[model samples]
Target chain A: MPTPTSSEASGPLAVETVGLTRAYDTLIAVADVNISIPKGSVFGLLGPNGAGKTTTIKMLTTLLHPSQGQARVAGFDVVRQAAQVRQYIGYVPQMLSADADLSGYENLLIFSKLYRIPAGERQQRIEETLSFMGLSEVARTLVRHYSGGMIRRLEIAQSLLHHPQVLFLDEPPWVLTRRLAMPSRNTCGPCGSAGGLRSFSPPITWRRPRSCVRLWLSCIKAGW
Target chain B: MGQTLAVAEAEVRKLRHDPVELLTRAIQPTLWLLVFGQVMSQLRGISSDGVSYRDFLAPGILAQSVMFIAIFYGISVIWERDSGVLYKYMVSPAPRWALVVGKALGSEVRSLTQASVIWILSALIGVHLRLELGAILGMLVLALLGSAIFVTLSLIIACLVKTRERFMGIGQLLTMPLFFASNAIYPISLMPAWLRVVAHINPLTYLVDGLRTLMLTGGSSAFGLGLDFAVLGLSTLLLVVIAARLYPTILT
Candidate 1:
């Protein structure tokens, strides 16, 4: 295995995978993937739909065994010291994996207890998690009734409940559109003001107004 | 310890939301008790040491229910793997033992509930319990110990198998053989000479015999009790070690 670079060695690394690979029979889902994520950094894994990002994340999180090489999360080996590695990280899968039959509060409480948050702190932690996720009112409601966004938010909340040093989020941005849209609106508001207004009007008028309308139609056809 | 409790708590919470699944879990066993027991009682030439067919069938069906419940241990693990919940648990701070224990305990608790329901129905159908309190306690202990072994075996299978369809296919294929090969439905002597040898080797045969001895014989023989307990204890420990070693490989 290659040694960590000086910069990497100096910084606190949250996750590190060296030559990680996963194969199913003949097909390789994840090829040699080596990445170092810094502590507390909100890293985004960008790739096309099937670029093996989920597979890579699965190996790093100790969910799937690597066919080759090794990984460390929060300084613990993913293979040799998996239980220790699990101690410092939280994982939110791409799909909603919470028990649909369980109440939101019950789900949080179960995970909090599983993580071994002390008995004295469990009630407070569960309440705080529910409040943080904006699920306090409906905490008693079954998760099957929760909307997709609510389920996603609750899942994120569950990951944070353990106060993990590292969090593996498979598709955080797609589920966090509200947060992503805020910064972009502020930065690009002035530059696209005229175009935005013109684009907005065509939808209301339901009329194609030549060049700009063609662009709107094309974008719509692509299903952006 | 905490992780096991958490997973068990989560499973319990799931039950609260979908109590029907709990009912569904009991349904198959109940059918065996009600329909199959009645049908088997009428079957010719199925006698066990002068006991009525219902008496013999009760313990067999009980063991069978316990076995069926244990098989879900692997099925649930595969479901978690496919659906990604296993990943969540794998990366959590929960100890591996906690995960294994929690799942096993959860299944045990579910099976016990089903067992209790069946026991009540058995009582209603005139299945008598002649044993004193000591035998009742022995029966409970044996059921719990036997469940641990079966659950561990289920986990080993689950950790080794990746796909749901394959797991189910193999699980179903093994269920009847494991049941029949044991001294569950008929006494070991009644089985074919070869099958009698196979039944003697089956860990489940000891469990069923232990349960029957406690329930029917009323815990009279110290030697029988000791041998039964020893067999069950040893098997539980061996299967658990195998499960623990295999678990990390699967999760990794």
Candidate 2:
């Protein structure tokens, strides 16, 4: 594995991309993008559909390799040190990620092991996550039986199990609305929603972490 | 290592939630033993190496059952992709190889279930089986290796096709040829010269040959038992690496 760059050790940015680009044949999905997301602050990439919002997220999350240029997440280069980048971040994609055949508890337990969470903390954390996500009532129930809202909450709970430092949400406003509607007691706060990209939705200011939120509402709504 | 087992444990856990799926899957093999094996045994022209044709067919059916279960595993990967489980797994810290191994291990569990069902049915139908500790262990090892190979092959195909429809089409096309090309239903000696050569190279041949030798009371295989293990072991190692290499392409 390659060592981290010198600036990465003391860098102020949690995520940084310089001249990052991705292309398919002649279509440039993401092009020459340069942005810096500071640590501990909420940052949102606002653009219309196909404005490369999801593509940007994919590159940053190490799910899609950049066709050209560089990106670093948590001081590790996305292309060179994808495994290291994976260790520091949690991603909730546009789609639901849990296995419907398994129960809510089983989904979280599997992720706990995948993330190599210590065996001692696994059960405790799973229980806590279930309660936090409001999934405790249906913990043992198959995820296939879970309503759409419950499935999203379970996904959020699974992502947060390892306590990642930087969390990425692709098109989360719909879920965010539901999440915003969640009782304040169990919701992960706005500040924890770092490195997010909101596209084409009405921008609403959050009362909590008011200074931390950055909204991008730049264009007329386009198809995603 | 822990991650690999975790991946496998997830699959096994799914089985626990729907045990009926296992029982349902056994119906095909059970019918084969109760109907086809008995009907085929009446043909005296096909030599059975001194054991009853039912006994000869038992191990062949076992290999075929395992192959069918494993070859369709790629379809699950396609489902996982659509449902978001594959994406979740991709971003994890676990090595890609662990994910592949875990899926294969899970398939092994399913294969073993099918094997047990076949074994019990064979005993009930009066097929002469050894039932010794060594024979049972040998059958188990062959089951695991056979399942691992087919499961890895399924993953490779999933990576190449990237869609449920395409994967299913390819899976259906491949399973029949792979089954018939090998000695799963009959001995290679009965095959034409051209297919006999293909059977020599087919991995399934080794599995059936090994199972028939260990499973039957007085069975002898043209290929030795050690060669079966060697071929299956080598093929499994190579397929695992290939599957791991192809895993990342699944998202693209």
Candidate 3:
């Protein structure tokens, strides 16, 4: 266990993983991969389905523990300092994480409580997040009534409620486009053009050309 | 503590959206109390302990209602997992136990509502109750403890099975046996020797026994309210620890 120095604390690296490997019995999902994401940089991971992109996201987000090796997110080791890592990082998984039964506002409010946001600040912050995600119009509407893109935006909004330093987006371009476009357009600096926006998507390959369709679109439309 | 409440509040918000489900849940216990208790109360053989059959059945029905409400809670975990809500909680800064406890607290709230319904139903059906504040509060506490125990058990099953089908199958399999095998439908003394052994070991037996003692008569019954509550409290505490420990395995 290495102690992080003051300089490393303020370093440009938002995420760094060295020799990070996750094996499920005989199969190694992510094998000895190393990558460093600089702060304030928007980096995309391109891999085919089952190519360990989600696995990498899981490890970095502290949702899945790495089998062997070292990984740090937001200056904290994901394995040893998972709570601290969670505090500084946000994750929007491939699937919709917000409760469908809850209104978009309720979902964000619940997350605010889980993150222990101050009572005085919670309502204002939730309003700000909803507005930032362009969801204020339907904040009171149940998430089940939300559109696919709206649900994705609500999830991203909830993750940003606590204002984490690093954000991990696991999925293809539509979510990525929303992730990149909405915040930059509305809030001006949160998850959009701001620091620590990492997106994961399936790789671009001739064998499976359809998977990267959104990838190309996001890069073109969102200007990523 | 705030995290626990947050998790519980989330569940409450969901429940609030589906308030009709709670009413639908009341139908089962309503049938048991109104129909089953009425029919069974007339039978002399089942009331050999000198207590009216309705009185005996009232507490049992309360316990059964809580069991029915809680024993299926695991299916929600699978739903949450599939819907990605569980993953969100897992990645949060909240401790795993806080999440589990929050879930249990959520179930506790449901069970509390169920208890109130049962109490009113029992009174309407002419089943005598202590009706005292202490008795009501005691029963509420026991209902919460009982609910926590079964909800934790459900969570354990959810963690182990990881799918709605298996969880529902196992949950259905466990609930009936747990209900009939316990003193919920019958006194342990009326059971055969083998069943008496099982009933003594079953946590529901303790819950039912506690409810019976607290609701039917003023003081303790043959099963001893002290022992009943002790077993339930200890078992709930133990299961909470086990459930929290098993909770993370569901993600893998």
* DockQ values per model: 0.46, 0.77, 0.69
**lDDT string, candidate 3, B1-252, tens digits:** 999999999888888888898899999998988887778777778742557887788888899999888999988988999988888899889999999999999988888898899898888877778978998889888999899999999999999999999988998899899999988877888899999899889999899888887887633476787898899999988988999899988987
User: Of the candidates numbered 1 and 3, which has the greater lDDT value?
Assistant: 3
lDDT of 1 at A62: 73
For candidate 1, the docking band is acceptable
Error of 2 at B99 (Å): 0.3
**Model 1: per-residue lDDT, tens digit, A123-212?**
887887777567899998998899888887788778767666566666543434352234321122211213222121111110111111
State every prediction's TM-score relative to the real structure: 0.81, 0.91, 0.89
Lowest-sum lDDT 10-residue window in model 1 chain B: B214-223
What is residue B23's positional error in candidate 1, in angstroms? 3.4
lDDT, candidate 2, equals 0.83
DockQ for candidate 2, C-alpha atoms: 0.77
- Identify the leading candidate in terms of lDDT: 2
* Tens-digit lDDT track of model 2 for B1-252: 999999999999999988998999999999999998889889998777677788888999999999999999988998898877899899999999999999999888999999999999899999889879999999999999999999999999999999999999999999998889988777777889999998899899999999999999888987899999999999999999999999988988
Q: Cα lDDT of all candidates, in order? A: 0.69, 0.83, 0.79
Residue A106 in model 3: shift from native, Å? 0.5
